[model samples]
Target chain A: MGFFDKLKEKLTKTKQTIIEKIEAIVPVGKKIDETTIEEIEEILISSDVGIKATEQITELLKKRVKEGALKDYNDLKLLLRDELYKILEDNTSLNLSNKPSVILVVGVNGVGKTTTIGKLGHKFVSKGKSVVFAASDTFRAAAIEQLEIWANRVGADLIKHKSGADPAAVAFDALEHAKSKNKDIVIVDTAGRLHTKFPLMEELKKISRVMKKSIPESPHETLLILDATTGQNAIRQAALFNEALGLTGIVVTKLDGTAKGGVIFAVKKEIGIPIKLIGIGEGVDDLKEFNPKEFVDALFD
Target chain B: MFEALSDKLEAIFKKLKGKGILKEEDVDVALKEIRIALLEADVNFKVVKSFIDRVRQKSIGKEILESLSPAQQVIKIVYDELCELLGGSSAKIQLSPNPPTVIMMVGLHGSGKTTTSAKLARIFKKEGRRPMLVAADLQRPAAIEQLITLGKQIDVPVFHSFDLKDPRKLCQEALKKAKIDRMDPVIVDTAGRMHVDEELMQELQYVKEILNPNEVLFVADAMTGQDAVNIAKSFNDKIGIDGIILTKMDGDARGGAALSIKEVTGKPIKLIGVGEKLDALEEFYPDRIAKRILGMGDVLSLIEQAQKAFDQKEAEKLKEKIEKEDFTFDDLKEQIRKMRKMGPLENILSMLPGANKLLKDIKIDEKEFVKVEAIINSMTLEERKNPKIINASRRIRIAKGSGTTVTDVNRLIKQFNEMKKMMKKFKHGKGFKLPKIFPF
Candidate 1:
């Protein structure tokens, strides 16, 4: 199946919960009234679209209502989709202009950073681009071994150190290996840490800084991996990680589950960070390039 | 991030403060703001709607509207409603009357089940129970190894078999071994899966039936958004969870999922994972969490932690010394050491009411405590007891010994004298008060 179709199927549960609820709230042939708008607002908030983004969308709809541009439920639905798409629209492609583009993956623990790295490496390796995996997540037990498995599967060289070694050293070595091997991409997988931990955040900054020693202006893409099920804290994660590392993009994972990944709407609206990828399932091929059009379609259609 | 909801509420109520009485319109306005704040905290809209309705009903009552400090009344109503929705109090895990009570951990992937299982085992082991950990999560790569590693760290035995691909069989064997080893409270760490995955859910059901766990805890991320209701409901319906364990409470997330899960599943949150350490798991207290959400501060938790760190005999000894006006740098150093044992100084301060707002712009440098300890360690016993003996040259020598500046040593001596003066006043039957020690 095509990526869109797969996304639609993976998001089928989310659609059934959110889209069906929206449809039920705003039925056909019903006039869009203030009560209907309020119900739609509840649906958006319940879907985790967040208060600010939901207000932005509803405010637009209210304006349309005032202008008499919004006539029916279908129009409101389309308008909502359009607004979400606009917020989500950005440069959703990875920056690989350099010969050995470095992608630093960071997030809180248990957000599927390692698995996403594996899938991401598979994507690049399958495109005939040599890749190098940096197992810089020296904190978690067996995290390196997990990434090593992914590297072997994706046919990418992995640079790792002992479990308690410095993560910056691991990233430094990976960059050196990538340069020597002339690899197309180097993905650095850092241990998952809560953004609230100042020391850990400092460590991530150090890793980013050390990469520049090997390649000036290295770590071309700093992606924060966010769990779809995560709530408002995702915004804090994005804001802090962006402030710390100048995060280039975000990768929303576990969309195959019931979570609509609705927090991304708030993340996009608040942080203005483009989502480069969406991980739909556990398979290596489940990772897909994020397309706002297809993503909105999967939600509304 | 956890302070956001309370901060917003505090802002709203600031306008209502000092008002003589609350009108119906005032209650409506307050409820509207509360609704938005709760929604922003990621509480489910339906839950927020009902919660607001209840709060409004109470706030609109004549007794509440006519009460003195109507704003405080409204806050109390909201806190009570929140506490009601969050459950009455903290609930403990129900150990079966029969030996070998089984606990099965289930949740969506990456919810910290494996780590939590180990933490739970450590807790039980500490309580003098032979708790065995079962690595039933055969889905995720290296998950078993991860559990084994954690088990090893805690010195707890973990049950795993490579030949047993089926989790049902794996769990069955693990239970048999637990019984044989006389391990009570066997914890089975199941693979994290989507709640909608029928095959995986069915597999969990099979294992649940086989083991007949005494407590099926639904582990969830405390940062989970509005989807918490659906996920919690699905797990409760699919495998019938007995309780919940919210992880990553150390994050700034306001943890509205705790409220949502409780509302939907009618299950109590038995525990919370506060940090990454193996012993960071803590018993869930709904009232304390409610206070935290309202920014009223978690004084009870703070007191509990303080009591654990401060020995009663030592405290009495120090009190007697203070009453006799013998407060010295050595005693201050000992008190600081005891306070340090209660965890991070910032965390301890954050537990005080209105401290979040107070400390928002101020960063508490814990290094100051280290510097104080070093300075105290450098002081001679005679010099510590008699600050008058520390001449200018003695200060310089002590500063060099402690690797601090002479100015720092002078400041410490001055602060110590001022603290002694304050204790002298308290010894005269005046109210006791702690003097500000940190420069910040």
Candidate 2:
């Protein structure tokens, strides 16, 4: 299947929760009323669009209804599609102009950081760019081995150190290796850490510094990977990670596994970071380059 | 967006608190808000709809107590409904009379099945079960290696085959090895796959037949909102998961999956994976979860934590110090470290009434306490006992020793001194005040 079909299929549960919920609420020829608005508000919040986004959408619908813009219940679906699409328009493209443009993948452990690194490797390699994998997540015992297998599968070079090594040193070595090899892109994987942990955040900063030491403008993209299954908790993560690293983009992983796709809108609305990609399935090539229109349409359809 | 999941629930309740005897309409409004909270908490849409309907039916026009308002009645009903929806009570993994009670871990990719498998073995091992983990997750490269490495860390035996391509045969052989090794409970960490893929489900079915696992504990990410509800149904239908293990409970997530999965799949959540640490698993309690989700302080879980984390003698001493406002930097460092070890600070603070409001937006990082430890460790005994003795040069020495900038040292000292001042105020029992120590 193509990326669009795959994303649509993966988003089936999310779409059912969002679109089907609305359809169930608004019967045929039902007039828009305060109760109807309240029901919509509840649906949006439950869908994980979050409090602020739900309130905004509800308020917008109310105002538009007052203005006679939404004459029928059907109009509300179109309005929701527009509202959600507008928020998802962040990070439409990546800046791949820099040779060996480094991308740092960071999140709490088991949010698919290694898997995403592998998938991104496939994406770039498919584009015929030389990619190098950096195992900076030296704390996790299997992280290096996992990345090694992924590197081999995707035909990317890897630079790693033994587990328990200082992660920043490994990052420095990986960058230096990338420079020597003249690779087109380098993806560095950092140990997953809770953003609330200041010490771990400090560890991340040290790694970033080491990368810059090797290449002045390295790590051009610091992408925060989040599990879509999580609700508002993902927002707090985005906020802290963004505050700590000024994240350039976000990759919402496991989209196929969540009914809270509204979380995508919540992250964008809260952090204002564009979702650059979304993992639709377990396949290495299932990472879809995020298109807001397609995503919103899939939900509303 | 940064609001804690409880903050929204509390806000709706708080708005209701000021009103006099509320009408049936008021109850409807609150119930609607509660429904929204449940959904936001990641309850399934259909489940939320039915839940709200039931609560609404019970609440509307019902004669509330003279002492209690409609809001309290509604909160009680919602809390009760939440508990019921979360399987009524905690469900422990049922052990079979037969030896080698098999536990097959299943979930979608990134749902933390592998880590949870190791965590479960660690927990059972602590309980004196000769448990072993089987690496059947050959889908991801080195996944078997991952499980094995985790096994080494926790000192548990891991069964795997580097050459085995068929997961079922590998599992069968592993079961044989487990039986020979006298493993009481063999936890099989199965390959992660999408629920939509029939071939993968069949793959799980094949492993299930070979193992005939006694307990099929489905590992799920707590962050999974509505999808968790549907996924739970599919897994239950396909492989018959006995219980759900909600992973990533350490996350700031409001935990919709925990609330929704039980109602949707009719299965109890047995364990919660709070952190990535090997021992971060906790026996799931529905009442505690309901209380936390509904903005009610979870005192039961909090006391349980205090009991597990500290000795009775230590707690008594700490209590005495706090009562007397005689906290030293050493005491502060010790308490912070202990609290950090207990789990996320938010989980702890949720035990205190009204602290949820403060904790909702707060970023409580245990790592911040690590810095405090560094600063305190750098100080002299005299300085630790009497902070007034530390001069500017001494501060610089302490900062250098701690490998931190002087500014960090300064901030720590400032916060420390401020906490002291607050404790002194608090000792006088003027009022209940919570310090705004957030975003650490």
Candidate 3:
């Protein structure tokens, strides 16, 4: 562990120590006081639970306090765990929709849309399904070429166009080919245009429309890919895209590189979107389907 | 009252003013906040972790200035470190001591290489150089057209072979055209793949060998975040890079790639695209960015951007209003709108030289400003000009009118009063003299 990592590890350890300290205090069967509440709030915030979510959790705890549930520290701990688990558990499982599942990966530029698609393709292809990639981000330099490279690496067929071609047209062609080829699944990669950029975002909407033109309920899942290093902003981006595109799931990339992995919990709580996959490394095999239990366990451990 | 973050940072640094004894714990606490804020802003965690550690080592037990608080000392350390992380100092594209310096643009698709190239060409033109663009990205249908369009818009010459099958040959021919046309600085725009494919790498290598360009810049979009960092590393490792051009600096990106790329790949960021406009290209200056990260405020970037976006005549008119102390709600609203165009509230504030430390803890919500704006817009001109006219009844009416509660209306009025009072103080004094990390 280098300087920053050691410091972070120490900081996190301090946080854990604080949590353990708090955990011990709760078990002492003392009434929860203002100091205790403040400590809990600090703990939550330090854990990157986010100010909003921490406030909500505090409010919920306050309500229990108001109800004359004069609980001691153990009861408080149980209450805290139960409330956190409730908020975090609902979106735990990755939902891979019915056969020939269409996972439409979306994000702003550089969130690893192409890489995520490649990893997802490898995951699906390895599971005995014929996967095809549609390179729909034709606006950026070499976007199509990048997708083709991923497609080749994963041993999946790719539908590509010349750079600056219509992304929606490419999606149209991919869906048509997928249907005809009887492909098990199709993963369409779209450009990460700013959600505020109406024209570029409108182009994405057009791609969704074109895909539906081929398979009425085609894009079975819209996974918003976020860079895990972005922390809360990743949550904001997910919210914006969800508002714009009604995302079905999320894929948080660069987990191995960032200490802001606390964002995974925050995103799950805030957006209520299942983290379908995570990109831990750059290799095709680096992506793993999000297992919430494993994630939480790794975090606490 | 505006809580521009710049103001809050000014307050923090003010407390630290002139007392430069930085203890390890002082650095630790300050770095804790800085780390969290950067991570919150979406900066890479590893980058933040390493950054804080470096600051810790350099800052611990340091006592270099009198009358300076540990906080200010720590801020100074972090500020300098951030500048260092961003590429020690600003590095310009070597103008080819000879005319027609060759620059090759490379990066994955959607990395904004093409747009950045055009922006760079425009920058060169401003520097009084004849810039010629080569449409070497022939794989894409409109890639060439995009370059040509940008060239036309900027009035720079673009060379292309729409029917060319080989990009290598096209680059050679474009170089020849540049020499013949006496266009000393030639920028060749190449194609990008999704990932680093061998064929594309070889193609890039071939182009580099044939052109023997002075600068090979990898144009990575800041919005791509970590992926751009990875791509830059791969491209640098595979094809070798002189520098990096981070596009989409205007996007709601936490800007980790800007801090991480230089450290990871050892390539200085040559240029950055702050906006979609052809003239939005800026020379990458690491020190200014570092100060911003430490909450010292990036006044230089803010000034540069303001200068670019400011209409001098309009600015003079605003200055006159400020001089007269007649700044109205309408003007306030207009400034808010213009500031939005600059970037997020926190982002813009951090870029000001020493403003970051002042605004450390202040949270300025974009939506809250929108609410305040709505309340202001709902008022009639007379009502806007005369605050006394807003009685309790009028407050209620305005609240209902603006889809807010009377409390919200009252809050806006109260906040606006505080803001105007602060502005008056600023007008009289040195306008909140924030401590400079470096004497201007």
Candidate 4:
């Protein structure tokens, strides 16, 4: 089991225990009292679902029961799942509709943002798509070299600027080259941002805005890469990034290593963003599309 | 435990804290520190660049000069941002709809794939499901036997294909057996390659094609840190894995692997293996993990551990006796036995979150407990119930019987008295703190 799976497993266990307890309480259409409702809330919170989300869920459950929609525990569970699913149902696909689709990836330090971009490029190239990668994360000494190595392995074209070059300038160059080369995809690996820093978030925003000027609504997807092992903190990152850059979709990595993977449910439940891809392993082929039903099933199963 | 990282943070914060507004020069200096920190923590260089860039943009504003403690403020901002980039929220495992769900485990050799498979089996079993283990890792000699050994230890059934030549055949037969046995879940532990070998990749691909597993989990080691991300990327690109399982988390405090892999490979980490013990696997709780990284003591975890160890009935009975002010040495002996059953004293201490710093140098070995137990055992039954009976003359005799010095016996009695007094004070709503340096 991976870390994300471990996280998810804990979450699933909590979900199951709560559902089972609720099931036992509302057997055969019996009305539940305040005590039972309170117990359910405690279960949700103990499962690390966050106090706010738990309160919100219980409130929703209370409303349903009052409206006579939830006749029993089973009915309440289904309703809860549906409500949780609704919070998770923002279906933001990886803007693949664009010709030469340009995706600008961003995250904070050590969030694997650049590597995710490299993985995306590798994925596209494996599908026989023409891919070009720009080393826009130029501050670090070995970053350009690292992307170059990945590009070589995946057999994709790559562009890089001198170390310490303006990242935006590098991105502009990559887009211009991508336009002339008829590349099917131009994945610009940008500098990771500190979402807490207005200036850092602003730089990311500026990069997105600049890309739009060059490619006319370019950076078709602002994919925010998050480490699944981060648990609830991943949510804070998403909120900060979404507020600043209008993150179109999310790419959750390292799900193979964590049980907190249940955080996806909480995140999608709270953030209302679509998870485009999940990283399952270190192999190039480990990335998979976010099939919500499949995901939920794997979690419960 | 996280000394490697804390040292780096201390150095960076030390320099940053001494400054006012962060200038281009300051950014360069800070970036250098971050670059070194990430490298030391084993964060991939590519990942570090974007991270620093993001932080620089946020820290380079006039807001720094406007702040009272700009360095601390900036550090706080970076910490929060770091938390966000790791993942805004946790990713969960996707369960299959149908019964007899198949979960395929894959990873590099020595990544603890087989062990993690067994741990998952135990988890599912405790959840009241019949989980069958399929020893699909046929490449290594005794791999099947290893899985079988773990299965027997956990009391879960293992399906092996010793007669089968190919791994895919083993998986097919295993899944078939799983369905026949009515096992609600099946875990197929696949063989790992030395690196990213073609034959192993083909074998994994073949197994996936045959099993059509509900979940394909990639097991990894946290000590590898950033390299694990690249490894995940390579595996995902080839096999299309579903989730991740990181092992050896109990060993590394920096937990950079937890930070980098998710963003690098685009996978949800589902489980974490804390130790080498059979029951060491734990559900990944991000908030608790973050709190641990920040060196905040986890009180809830301590309470949970105590709950697991102390029987409620026994605890209630003991509390009643203590309430009556009838605490005895026998009770202390029972508590010591309970602690032994709870496993290593160091493990309990380390899990206390911020207790790491306090207990870092205190070596609480079994010998210490043994000495205390010997002193009590040498006492008469009446003396055991009431240590006040063991006065100087009685203590001398008891010390002779236990093969210890009279002073040793006297020290034990003194410690017991202090502990009793502290308990009494706590019961009476008085503040009673344990001595900073326990004599024993």
Candidate 5:
């Protein structure tokens, strides 16, 4: 199956909450009305597209309706597609423009941070790029071993430290090793859950600074992997990481789960960070470049 | 999506602040706002409808509360109904009078079954019970190792086998080992698939049959929103769950699952994983969750004054100062310093209703607090006593001394003013702004 088809199948759970509901409301050629717009608004919010983004879409739909441009719910779908795409406009593509680019993966614990890094490494290896995996998530138990297993499977070199070692030191060593080995990419896997309950993770900041010591332009892309099923709290997680690390892109994972992953629009709308990828399944092939058109299309499909 | 629910309510309440007599239309507007907020937060539409009905019945044209404003009574009614929807009271983990209360942790992969199993052990350990972690999740490549490692950190013993692949057999042996070791609670971390499938369910059924766990915690991710509810229902129907453990709770604030899980699946959320650490687990309280739903957490702290035990004289003086609108940046700085020493500033700030709005909107952390602390400490005694005496050059000096940006210094003073404004409302008992402030 094609990637989009796979995404569609995986996102069936997500689609259940969105397209299914919308289609049920505005089938084939139903005329749009006030109640229809309200139902559509509720659907958008239910999918976690968020209030602001949903309001933006409804606002546009209302304007179109007022202008006599939207005669039916069929026209409403086109308007939503246009408005949703606008929120995701940015540097959405992975910036592989620089060789030996350092990719930093960060997220809260249990958001598949390590798995996404492993999957990314596998993708790079398949594309004929020499990749080195950094086990900077040394705080999480057996995080190194888990990454090491992925490294071995993908034929990528892994730079790791003993469990519980300073994660920043591991990241720094990995960058130095990647540079020395002339690796095409260095994937730095930071611990998702910092030991400190304190919200500010100086360690994350410290790691970024230490990587610059190895390569001034290290960490070229810092991608935050968020869970697809997350609700309003996704904003808090995204804001913290985005503010602290100045995140370049975002990847919403576990799209296979029964959630439209509408928080994607929320993150983009609230933080203005382009979502670069989506994780639809557990396999290495599940990570796909986030296409806004395709994503919003899939939401209604 | 996180604060969307409370923020909407806050907006509505803000409008209703000085409306002495809330007309039916006013209540209608508030209910409509509440309905949208709840639905937006991913609360089931049916549940939201019923909740609105309950709040409307109690609040519409109720002139009984003479001391309280109409908006305050409406919020109180909604809060009480929300609490009822959230399982009324906390349903704690069912501890067996007999030792070795088996807790079978089951959920989808990446739902945090293993880590929460460890967290459960830690919570039980804090209660002086010997908890053993059973690594039944041998399906994942390193799930066993992950559980064992988490076990070591928490000083709990882990039972896992290299050869044993069948979780049923592994759990049986682990239960026997727990009994032998006199462990009070044997936590069995079961394997999880990407989605609910028959094989995984049957295997869990086997393990559940063998262990006869006292509690089968359906570990669900809080971020999953409504999906968490459906997954919980699936698990509860297929394998039967005694309760739920909502993970990554601190990540998102909407807590749609917290509302939906109990109302839809008929299962209480026993605990919540506030953070990733094993010790990050907190007992789920309906009152607290309800207050959070209404954005009343900060108002609770402000009204309860549990932290007032720190300095009674200072507390009384501060209350009087706030009532008389005598609060200043000096008092603000001192209160923040004292609050930081007492507990997390969010908890202290969350006590004040408006503080939550400001904190939620602003990206402040401990590092900012450090900068705030340094800026205050750098000030002379006079500056500390009277922040009004400080000027731009003095701010630059303080920033230079503290090694912080001017924005940091500015934020401190700005936050100080906001605190004073909010505290004045709290002290007067004039029903503060409906949405953000405590309904006094």
Candidate 6:
């Protein structure tokens, strides 16, 4: 199946609920009133679309209603899809200009950083690009082993140190190995840490800095993996991680669950960090490029 | 964006403070602000709607409106409702009358189940119960290894079979082993799975049927958004969870998921995972969490932690030294050590009322504590007791010994003297200020 078709199928639960809730709130031929608008707002908010983004979308609908552009529930639905799509639309490709381009994956504990790296490795390997995996997550128990399994599965070379060793050293060694091997990409997996932990954040910064020692302007892409189930704190995660590492993009994971991944809209609206990829399932091939138009159509169509 | 719900409520109530009597409109305005704050905290919109409706009904009553200090009354009503909704008080895991009580941990992917299972085992071990960990999570790569590693760290035995692919069989065998080994409260760490996956959900159901776990704790990330309700409801429907465990509570997330899960599943949050350490598992307190969600600060938890960290005898001796105005670098180092025992300084500070706003601008460098300890350790006994004896030469030597600059040593000495003076002033019934030696 095509990635879009798969994404639509995976997101069917979220889409059905969203569309079903709106339809249930207001019949197709019925005019959208204040009560209908409030109910729609609740549906979006409940989906983790967030208060700010929902307000923005609702405000636009109200404006369209005053201008006589919005007539019925169908018109409101179409307009909502378009506005949501507009907010999510952005450059969703990786910047791989440099040889052995470093992609640093960072996030709070349990957001699927290692699994996403495994899938990303599969993608690059499929494209005939040589890849090196850096198991810099030297904190979590068995984290390195987890990444090692992913590396072996995806046909990528893994450079790891003993658990509790310096993560920066692991990243540095991986970059060196990738350079010596003349690899096309290096994926650095750091330990899952809450952004509130200052010492851990500093450690991540140190890893980023040490990468520069091997290749100037290294770590071309610093992606923060956000769980789709995360609420408003996704914004905080993005803001802090961006401030600490200048996050280039985000990879929202676990979209196969009931979560609408609506927090990404808030993340994009507030932080302006584009969503580069969406993890639809637990399988290695479930990762797909995020397309805003298709995602909206999948929700409404 | 990081505004605590308490700060927003404070702003709203500040306007209502001068009003002699509450009007319906006044209550409506307050409830509106409360609704927004709750929603911002990631409370389910339906839950928030029902909650606001209840609070509004109670707040706009004739007696409440006519009561003096109606704003405080309204605040009290809201606080009570929140506390009640959060399970009234802390709920303890129900221990089975039979030995080898089984606890099955279930949650979506990345919810800290494996880690929390080890923590739970550690807690049971500390309570003098022979607890065993069962690695039933056969899905994720290296998950069993992770559990085994954690079990080794806590010195608890982990039951696992590399040959067993079926979790139901694995759990059944683990339980039989636990009974044979006299291991009570067997914690089964299940693989994290999406609730929408039917096959996986049915797998969990079969395991649940076989295990008949004493406690089926639904582990969840504290930062989970609106979907907490759906996930909790599905788990409760499928496997019938007994309680909840919210992980990563150390983060600054408002943790509305706790409230949402409690509301949806009617399951009490039994414990919370506050840090990465094996001992960081804490018994959940609904009042403290309610206060945390309302942005009112968790003073109760802070005090409990402080009491746990500080020795009463040591505190009495420190108090005597402070009264005598003879607080030395040795004493300061001892206090710092005890303070370190109470989690991170930033985390402790965050429990203070209005500390979130204070912490927003100031970066608390935890490494400063290490530096202070090093500088103090570098000091000789005589120099530590008598700061006057530490001359420029001694300061230089100490700086070199501690691998710090002379300026840093001088600053510490100066601050130590200033703190002594402030203690004296405090004894003399004057306002006291903390010494600026440590970075905020």
Best by the DockQ measure: 6
Of 3 and 6, which scores higher on lDDT? 6
lDDT of 2 by residue, B1-440 (tens): 11355677778878878887766777777777776666656667678888888888777664563546767877788788888988897889988798889999999887888889999898889899899999988888789888999999999999988998999899889888987888979999988887767888998988899899888988887767656766788899998988899887776666777777887788889998876678778888888777777767778877888778788999889778878767788987787777677876765775665676676566556666677788889998888888888878988999999988788878877877787777667777776565533326
* Backbone collision tally, model 5: 9
In candidate 6, how many Å is residue A63 off?
A: 2.0
The sequence of per-residue lDDT tens digits that candidate 6 reaches over residues B60-99 is 8786967878988887888889998889988899999988
Q: Judged by lDDT relative to the true structure, which candidate is superior, 2 or 3?
A: 2
Between candidates 2 and 3, the DockQ winner: 2
Query: Per-candidate DockQ versus the true complex?
Result: 0.71, 0.43, 0.09, 0.01, 0.34, 0.80
What does chain B score (TM) in every candidate? 0.89, 0.87, 0.67, 0.83, 0.73, 0.94
**TM-score for each of the candidates:** 0.93, 0.83, 0.56, 0.54, 0.80, 0.96
Clashing pairs in 5: A229-B223, A229-B224, A230-B223, A232-B1, A232-B2, A233-B252, A233-B253, B298-B350, B298-B351
Clashes of each: 0, 10, 48, 118, 9, 0
List the pairs of residues colliding in candidate 1.
none
> Native contacts recovered by candidate 4, as a share?
0.00
* TM-score, structure 6 vs. true: 0.96
> Which whole-number lDDT from 0 to 100 does residue A141 have in model 5?
78
> Per-residue lDDT tens digits of candidate 4, residues A48-157?
35445767889988887778776666676667677656666656567777778998888754456655766787788878999988888775335676678778878888
Model 6: per-residue Cα lDDT over A102-216, one tens digit each? 9999999999999999999999999999999999999999999999999989999999999999999999999999999899999999999999888889999999999999998
Instruction: Kindly report which residue stretches of model 1 are placed more than 4 angstroms away from their true locations once superposed.
Output: B321-337, B364-440
- Model 5 segments more than 4 A misplaced: A85-91, A193-199, A296-301, B1-11, B39-42, B62-68, B195-199, B292-440
- Flag regions of model 3 displaced more than 4 Å: A1-106, A110-192, A195-235, A243-245, A251-272, A275-301, B1-26, B29-53, B62-68, B126-129, B139-142, B148-157, B194-196, B223-231, B306-440
Residue A25 CA error for candidate 5 (Å)?
A: 1.8
TM-score of chain A of 3: 0.81
Model 4, chain B only, scores a TM-score of 0.83
